[model samples]
Target: MVQKIGAQYLAKRFADQLMASPEPREEPEEVVRETTEVSGDLDGQIFHDEEGQPIGRAYLVRQVEVYVVSPTRAGAREELVRCLNEPDSRVYLREVDGRLSGVVYTPDPARTGERTGAMRADDV
Candidate 1:
């Protein structure tokens, strides 16, 4: 689904940013976890709280985890996730491999019941 792909992309981007920061002198492996935190209703609606308003439509992008082996990893992860999801983050959606990618408000793609988990670039 578009939302699933979007969340994965966002999580990856956030993970990458943390790895590239100067706080981490050594490179750290990116750990991306994509899970359906919430599913849409029959009508394809997702509800979220926006300041006091109830936003009824929008694909929710969340960070399940973004961390490094260093002590500053948790703080770095928190800052990066907050920055990416903030109003000024300027994050947008993109399409890759025929599926919608990145974080943006949009409709989800239909599920085709296929999965390719953790395929490395060399495997392609």
Candidate 2:
């Protein structure tokens, strides 16, 4: 049987692979911010799409940065965008070794988010 690895290691490895090459940065998706628009007495009126076309209901968006991470050469890519007035250092991260990779949101305000398993020599 193969040995199992931990997220700390995988996350670090993934981060390193992406950061190693800074060129050809892909475009990041914009974040959407939803707000209620009153047409008459409606407080929770339905929202529209980015094109102002009615989509039944919609909301929210952000950032001007694309921080990408992929597990395989052809694996799915996840990106994090920089919120307004947010630092570019803000990056997307995944530490779990599950079949599907999802961004692991952290409330840690500190920029320590960047230091993952492989991100630090000590983590290795």
> Tell me, what's the RMSD of every candidate?
26.0, 21.8
Q: Which regions of candidate 2 fall more than 4 Å away from where they truly are?
A: 1-43, 58-79, 82-115, 118-124
**lDDT tens readout by residue for model 2, 17-63:** 98896678686698566644433343345767799886664332222
Residue 16 deviation, candidate 1, in Å? 46
Question: Which candidate number maximizes TM-score?
Answer: 1
Candidate 1: tens digits of C-alpha lDDT, residues 11-74: 9999998887577366558867665544434234655576657667665444322232112545
Task: Score every model by TM-score.
Answer: 0.25, 0.18
lDDT for predicted candidate 1 compared with the true structure: 0.51
After TM-score superposition, what is the CA distance of residue 10 in candidate 2 from its true location, in Å?
63
Q: What is the lDDT of residue 56 in candidate 2?
A: 67
Report the Cα lDDT for candidate 2: 0.45
RMSD of 1: 26.0
